[model samples]
Target: MERIEGSGASQLVQLIRAIGYNSEITFELATVTSAPPQLKIKVDHMNVELEKDDLIVAQSLTKHMRKVNLNVKKKASISSTSIDSLYTLTLPQGSGEWSLLSFGLNSADFKVEEAELEFTDELKKDDRVIVVGMNEGQTYIILDRVVMY
Candidate 1:
C-alpha cells in the first residue's frame, strides 16, 4: 500500500488536535453599568464591554418576581396529644402550594416552602454579576448577581 504520511495522515492529525481543543470557558466578574435586557456591562479591571445580544441572563434577573421552586424539607416534632392539628404555623417562605404533612405522634412532621420576589426594578447600574465566557469569549452568559446580605 501507499505510505500513510503521503496520503492524508498530516491532515488527520490536525483534525484530531482540533477535537481535543477545549472550549474557552472563563468566569469573569463584571459590573452592570446600565440596566439589563440591554446591559452595558464592563468587565472588572478589563477593557471588555460584554455585548447584550450574546448574553444569557438568568430569568430571576429579568422577570418581576420569578417563583423559586426549590425542594426543601423541614421536620418539627410535637410531643403533646392536644396538638392534633397545625394552624397559623409560620413557614420559612412560600408562593406555591406548599405542604406540611403530619406523620404520627412519634414520627413528627415535614414542611415544604416556596416564594417569588419582584426583580424588574432590581438589576441596575453598579450591580455586580457573574459572567461566563464561552466560545472563546464571543458569547457571555450572565449567571447571577453577586450579593451579600
Candidate 2:
C-alpha cells in the first residue's frame, strides 16, 4: 500500500513537471490605436515568412497617416525574454486595399535581420498589396511567438 502511494505521488510529480508553463502576453500599440482606421483600409491576415510574398489591404488616409507601433506586455505570472536583439518586421503589398505585414523573429537569438514595408502590383490583378521579408540568405528566423490586434 505504501509503495502504491509513493508510485502515485511520483506519477503526479512527473505529470506536473511535464507540463511546461506558457506565458500570456497582451499586445499594445504605442502609436496606433486598435480602433478601426478612419479611412477605408483592407486588413488581411497572413503569416510572415522569409522570402515569401504575402497579400494585404491598403488604406488610403484622407487624414495624416501615423506610424503603427506594437508593444507587448506580460502578465504578472510571466515574463518576456528581450526581443531587442531579435526580430524584424516587414510590410508586404497585396491587392486593392489588402496589404501584408511580416514579422521575422531570429531563430538563433531573436534579432531582426530584415524589416521593410513594401507595395507591389505584380502578384494578383489590381490589388494594392504590401509584402515584407528578409533577403534570401537570411532564413534564420523562426516565428514562435505572435499576437494579433
Candidate 3:
C-alpha cells in the first residue's frame, strides 16, 4: 500500500484497511460508561443499537500492563495504628472497624474481603473507545482504550 500524507490520507487508509480486513467488520467510535460485564457503550453515527452485555473486550486491551492511578480516597477503614497496616486504610476507606485492641480496628466490616481485589478499572465517562464489529449486529470487541483529547 502506498503511503499518503495529510488529513485526506487517514480516511483513505481506513478504507484501504477495510479491503485487507473483511469489509463486514468495521471500526466505530464509542463512548464507554458503567463497568465491565455490564459495560454500556454508545456508538457514534450509526443506527445499530447496542446494549449491556453486548460487548466483549480484547484481552490485550484490558491488560494491566499500563500504569494507572491506584485509586483515590473513598470510604476506607483503618486497620491498625502501626505503619504496616496503614496501607489498608485505603482498602475500603470507611469506618468498618472491628478491633478489640482499638488500635488495629479500621478494617472492612468483615464483608469486603477478597472481593475488593476483583475490582476492575472502568473507563471514565465520555472516554472514547474503538470497536470492531460486524454490521450484521454481531458482538463488538473493544479494540483498545482511547481518550478523546
Query: After best superposition, candidate 2 residue 105: deviation in angstroms?
Result: 14
Error of 1 at 26 (Å): 0.4
Best by lDDT: 1
Residue range 1-149, candidate 3, lDDT tens digits: 55555344245436656566766776767777655555677877666547656787776644244433343243345554465432233225675754343443343343332232332455555667778776565678777766432
Residues 43-129 of candidate 2: C-alpha lDDT, one tens digit per residue: 223232222222122333112344444333332232355545544344456333433333443332222334443332122322222
> lDDT (CA) for every model shown?
0.65, 0.28, 0.59
Q: Which candidate order results from sorting by lDDT in descending order?
A: 1, 3, 2
List, residue by residue over 4-117, the lDDT tens digit for candidate 1. 342243334334445555457766677898785577788765786776787888777775665565443454554555656654544566644544544444444554457674
Model 1 C-alpha RMSD vs. true structure (Å) is 15.3
User: What TM-score does prediction 2 earn?
Assistant: 0.13
What 10-residue stretch in candidate 3 is worst by lDDT?
110-119
